[model samples]
Target: MTANVQNLNAERYSNEVFELWANQQNLNKSEDYLLKKYITDTSKHVLEAGTGGGRLSFYIEEKGFNNISAFDVVPNMIAHAKKRASTNDSNINFSISDAAVLENYESNSFDYLVYLQQVLCFIDKKDLFTNALKEAYRVAKKDAIVMFSFLDYESKIYNPALSSFVNVLRKLRSEEQSSRHLPWLKINNDINWKLFHKNQPKTYWVKRAEITSLLEDIGFSIEEVKNANQFSKNTGKRKGILYVVCKK
Candidate 1:
């Protein structure tokens, strides 16, 4: 992962208001289909990787999933999450962690793990992304459900997030060279499209096949895969984040 990507991830989600926006996302749905369908027992130990501002953590708690812990690479984001947790009196253990290296967690510690909101895309290096998957796989128990979501390369428009990153690339390189030297490098046999989001820093995207193969390689079985945005339709069609549900 590039230092630029790391700095960007830290800089973007520093605000407290973003947490409210994150929580507001699933209000329309009567059920968290991903959580409800895959996670039946509220007692299961849950971990939210890349838990920005603890929005999903808060939501999962509302649904009675009490055994939850969350982490983020950004300290300010974790601070915001901690503030929210304090306000709500939620017993969620918030911590600082890198997905590729779960320094604090032990193997087989959690029953359910969620890498939501395209957070996986933030690890700019494909190998780092894979290593993170390996860590996630290691920490989760057998038959555990793991859900990862990302912004699709085939999205209808270039989101503001992409625009910000593009602008950064443009600044680093001459317009002529940047056109050629974008972040989309073809790494060893992984993904042709590991595009990260700009606004949210390390947030990025990869092909579904690459994700599936990587998960299987790391011992996860594919259960269901779909665009997370499918739940929220706009302009008469589903548009937004790509996601997968896997069982370990």
Candidate 2:
């Protein structure tokens, strides 16, 4: 389900976008408190998936947890993060690796693994998304904390229609709009969503039950499906983000 080079290149973690994102994130205060409440002392060695701009690294470090390793699929994002690393001397391990295939990390090495900002949605294909979860499970210690977020497509604002399909076609053909939304569905428990971002390939939106079942199938024990908006004042589009705290 990898999008072609044409689609992948659109807004694909460019330096300009990441700079704006990082700048806005630096102003956020509640995120630190949110992570602090969930992260504990047992998570000495932490791994973060989809380390966009490495903003989470700062909040993670602020809580006195230094042994942090993070990675992103985009080389540009990693380069920017590494540059930011040079200025802070945080020593965070930032690398380039796809979340779907994390061949670099060792099994059972991490106490905590996190993939935030609705990162799973980018893995639009259900099979690869499952494989990614399987990889995350493989890399975590037994009973380790596995925290991540999912974007719920059941939001009222989301109305996938013919226009949405047209938008996707335009994107794939590079004829018109750079980005568009397509339908999202729970086909027998496997989640699927059409590409919305102009860049990158694959898209996925999930239901709570579908995601819970997927995690259980991957051998993770359920802890709680947290509503993340409670921790922040996010509304409208941002309100769909759901944080899942599970054990592996």
After the best TM-score superposition of candidate 2, give how far the Cα of residue 104 lies from its true spot, in angstroms. 0.7
TM-scores, all candidates, are 0.74, 0.76
lDDT of 1 by residue, 8-28 (tens): 545545542344433444533
Write candidate 2's Cα lDDT for 5-64 as tens digits.
422522444532555544435523334554766678744898988777788876687778
Clashes of 2: 1
Candidate that scores best on lDDT = 1
Summed backbone clashes in each candidate are 6, 1
User: Can you give the lDDT of residue 134 in candidate 2?
Assistant: 91
User: Scored by Cα lDDT, where does model 2 land?
Assistant: 0.68
Positional deviation of residue 70's Cα in model 1 after best superposition, in angstroms: 0.6
Q: Which parts of model 1 have CA positions greater than 4 angstroms off?
A: 15-31, 156-203, 229-238
